[model samples]
Target: MQAGCTGCRSKADTFDIAMAFQPIVDAETGRPFAYEALVRGSNGEGAYDVLSQVTPENRYAFDQQCRVTAIELAVAAGIIDTGARLSINFLPNAVYSPVACIQLTLKTARATGFPPDRLIFEFTENEEMADTSHVKTIVETYRKMGFATAIDDFGAGHAGLGLLAKFQTDLIKLDMDLIRGVDTSLPRRMIIESVVRLCENLGITVIAEGIETVAEYEALRAIGVRYIQGYLLARPGFRTLPEITLPGGSIAAAA
Candidate 1:
């Protein structure tokens, strides 16, 4: 964290951010396991448009606001009654103190009636984490506090196997690059199949993301990947939850 990152960062925080949600659904059952809150502008802008405003000075505030916004908007979008969990993407570098930074999220959760246990804090492995120890601490602390922690873009990032060996997060979404052409690539299939078994042995749930074609989805299912997230299922809905399109031309509510 930088110099301006202290406490709630209420004074330095100035940007406005909104959320878009997409479901991570069970492959076989077509039931939503969780809905990931993706950052967007107030008027349904793309993530890059919103993330461009985040700077080192206000990074902490942005991260804090993201959590609160995600929870509040998700509840308003009717996630409260659904059994599905809420997965929030977080910035590890922006967190100075785990407990202090999460206070606003806790407050928002309490206010919105979102159960703390139903939230999953996700950080991408693509981010160049300066300190692995800090990330490990954050993950352990969050899990102990009843919040699930996940590492996103697992296989394609700054750290791969080494990071996984250390964190062993509750969930991991195999990178889309690894998933994109798996149905046609034998090596891709071999690697993903192997990773699935590894995750099963390690007690980490594997989510095959960025699934596009029927061949890709079928290939993943054959490899035994249970949770799937991508356009083949549903696209991220701005300020709402998009309905999932299951295989065989059937549609299912994301909730």
Candidate 2:
């Protein structure tokens, strides 16, 4: 850990936490493209149990710890050798300084021998950004450091196209509300198609999240979406990395 990380380390005494992982598979190859690290209680409780304890004072610590723990556990689970990316949800508001806050993460990744290029820092829409400039700095800095950045829950939050226009992100996760029943709804399909097109134009990869059925999955695949994540593939494995099961397609085996 860096010298600047002392504040967060001191604040880390507030809570105990763990992680769960769900694979985000490639639509064409059915291979694990990434594993999103979801927070959980150390005793196997829900995310709420862990997140409810996060306050402004400890937010920085919590965010830092989450990144370190996720990478540590993923390394222990051999995810570093799987050639799959690790998607870690980060609290942009908690990040006081992008360069300073990232030192611990850099140290942890290096210690574990995980590839920095394969790390994806996902910013959630639920966390209202008080300063867009700070958020932009975080994204830009992370990208320059050889890590990918993404906007999570796109349609469900205030930071939609407007925010995307202000900063560059490598990917955006389509919210479940926009994807639910999209297979049967023309309007939903049209909306998703338009979003996909817009993202494609901006050179941002689109990931359809929260898919629950074969119909939804097929619909997304047909829409030319190459990346996907949801219970239809695998649920978050509490303190573990869940196995991925790909739907039958032209590709016979897991890539």
Supply every candidate's count of residue pairs whose N, Cα or C atoms clash at under 3 angstroms.
Answer: 0, 0
Q: Tell me the whole-model lDDT of each prediction, alpha carbons only.
A: 0.89, 0.86
The residue pairs found clashing in candidate 2 are none
Off by over 4 Å in 2: 1-6, 248-255
> How close is every model to the real structure, measured as TM-score?
0.96, 0.94
Clashes of 2: 0
Q: Compared with the true structure, what per-residue lDDT tens digits does model 2 show for residues 105-183? A: 9999999999889999999886789999989999999888999999999988877878988997999999999999999
lDDT of 1 by residue, 1-255 (tens): 444346356765656778999999998789889999999988888899988888866777788889989999999999977789999999998888787788889999999999999999999999999899999999988988999998899898899989987778999999999998999999999999888999999999999889998999999999999999999989998899889999887998755
Model 2, global lDDT: 0.86
Candidate that scores best on TM-score: 1
Candidate topping lDDT: 1
